[model samples]
Target: MTLDDALAALKSHVEEGRAEGMAAYHKQTREVLGIPNPALNDLTKSWRQTLTVEERVALADQLWQSDIFEARIAAAKLLTQARLRPDAAAWALIQSWVPDFDSWAIADHVCMAGQKRLVADPSRVDAVEGWTQSDHMWTRRAALVVTLPWTKQNNPKSDDLAIRDRVLGWAASYVEDHEWFIQKAVAWWLRDLSKHDPDRTRAFLDAHGEKMKAFARKEAGKHLT
Candidate 1:
């Protein structure tokens, strides 16, 4: 089926329950100084069961052309789940859209799933590095979180170390960043990495103790101690 057909099929499934849930979440978010974009959440919950990878990509391109941020986020979600597809285009879209990722939810959705698609490729490291230095806080957080699944799978040591170092370096640089989501992701990355190599994490934290934030140190130490 065509991308338009797939999108229309998916859009028809946007239930009241999903919309209500999204609206409620948006309300809670607004109360906490967060951006309350509901379209992504609503679209995510309405994913189609039969959409093909190419159709999703086409939909993403269409949504991006239309400047529909929520629809693009939904399309990203769909592409991420189409496991065997080449993700170069999706990565390019995310890179171009990184500066626009003002919310932690959308950034996390893109990174967590989009990063999964990049694990086997060496070229993705450079993209992660560039994201680590991005001015956007969520992009920096995405750079760190994208490595989480790799660390957990205990992939080849070479790949693991490259991603590990980038995550730690990003966390170190943002240790004192006041952004709650970035700070929390820093702690979460440390906590996840600590499970893979407690001794190494302890050593790194010890060496960087003075520079590490309290929350991050606490998270890293949860299992190490």
Candidate 2:
């Protein structure tokens, strides 16, 4: 379907009074449709099944440029699938959106889409390293959020273990960042790592926990106990 068709479908499901609340909660300046996520999820699921990859890419790009809250989210959901065998175009589109991230919800949604692509080709980690060095906090934060899969490998291959250590190094670099979200991202990675690899998680905390914000440290250690 076309962008107009997709947007019309989303607009049909909007909750009348929720837009203001969503905008306020997200601190977003863009138009908010107040469409619940489940509706968006279902819509994108249907779109994914119906549309060709090129069609989905075009629609996702249009929806993202519309600057409407839920449309951007729909754009992300459309690309969240794991099995795009030759996904160079999809990966490129997701990367293009990184510099524009201003809010957590949108960034996280896009990052979720990105996680699949990154896993499909781990070489993208080198590009993600560039995001960690970006001036935009959300871009920096996306590096960790997108690599979260590395945090949970109970029976990791040697390659996976190396990836885990690489991400941990990124987290350690972030420990000195006083931004609440950065600290939270570092803590989040450690917390998830704690579930499958407690010793490494504990070691991270021991080395960098003292430097993290108290709330982040607490969150990182919450599952440890």
Candidate 3:
């Protein structure tokens, strides 16, 4: 379907006063239609059922360009599938949106879509490595956000272990950033990792806790025994 068509569908479900409160909560200046996520999910799910991968990619691209809050989210939901064949377009589109990430909500929906892409092809980790060095705070944080899957493997194979350590290394480097979001991202990775790899979590806290913000250190070690 067309951008106008997709947008019209999105506007059809707008919940009157919700948009204003959502914009205030997200601290965003963009157009917020206040369409709740379930509606977006419902709409995109139907769209996904009908569209080809390429068609979905084009529609997602347009929705994102519209820059309305719900449209961006719907764009992300459109590509959130894990089994899209030849997902190069979806992956590339998600990567292109990274630099524009200003709000955690949109960035996170896009990253949820991206997590599947990265899992599909781990070589993309090398490209994601480039995000750690970006001047954009959210881009740097997105590196951790997108790689959070690496934190969930309880009995990860050697390659998975290596990837976990690599992400931990990035978290180590992030301890001194001081931004609340950065600190939270680092702590989030560590706290999640602690569930599957307590030893590594403890080591990270021992080595970097002093450098980390107080709340982050506590949060990171929260799951450790």
Candidate 4:
């Protein structure tokens, strides 16, 4: 099917799932977060069945331009399945969605899967690193999460200290962020990294203990003795 067809199908699927009065909740979330866009928390429970890589890419392109949050989310879901595809165009489409990310759901949905594609193709790491420093909190969260697979794969080693340091630095900068999502992301990265090297995490925490926010410290405590 063509991109238009895929988008149309996705939009219909999303509209069917839209909840009454959800607009109020979306507005409240935006107001509380100081974000400018309308958001929808509801999402499809499943992806479109077995979409071709090209079809998925087309859907992603269309969804990227959509004003509706669910449309964009649907696109992200489709892209996750296509993450293993070797299409450069598909990767570009995936990368383009980073700046548009506005919520943890979007960041986690895309990054957890797209990260494998990125690590396999190292060129994508630069973009992730750049996002880690972005002013946008979601982008930074995406950067940290995109490395999750790598950390899980290699665990912590002296050789990977630089990577660990970078992740910790990102967490440190955002540890005290008032935004709950940002604080949670900081906690998550610390917790995930701690799984690799609990000792190093303890050292890092102790060294920067005074600097860590209570929430981060609490989360890190899961693995750090």
Give the best candidate by TM-score.
Answer: 3
The whole-model C-alpha lDDT of candidate 2 against the native structure comes to: 0.92
The CA lDDT at 47 in model 3 is: 99
Worst 10-residue lDDT window, candidate 1: 27-36
TM-score of each: 0.75, 0.98, 0.99, 0.74
Going through the candidates in the order shown, the clash numbers are 0, 0, 0, 0
lDDT of 2 by residue, 49-93 (tens): 998898888899999999999999999999999997568898999
Instruction: Arrange candidates, best lDDT first.
Output: 3, 2, 1, 4
Kindly list the per-residue Cα lDDT of model 3 for residues 97-192, writing each as its tens digit: 999999999999999999999999988999999999999999999999999999999779898888898988898899999999999999999999
Q: Residue pairs in steric clash, candidate 4?
A: none
Per-residue lDDT of candidate 1, residues 18-79 (tens digit): 55465355432321212134644455545534555555566666654443334545655765
Cα-based lDDT for every prediction:
0.63, 0.92, 0.94, 0.62
2 or 3, which is superior by TM-score?
3
Rank by TM-score (best first): 3, 2, 1, 4
- Pairs in clash, predicted candidate 2: none
Cα RMSD of all models vs. native, in order, equals 4.9, 0.8, 0.7, 5.5
Off by over 4 Å in 3: none
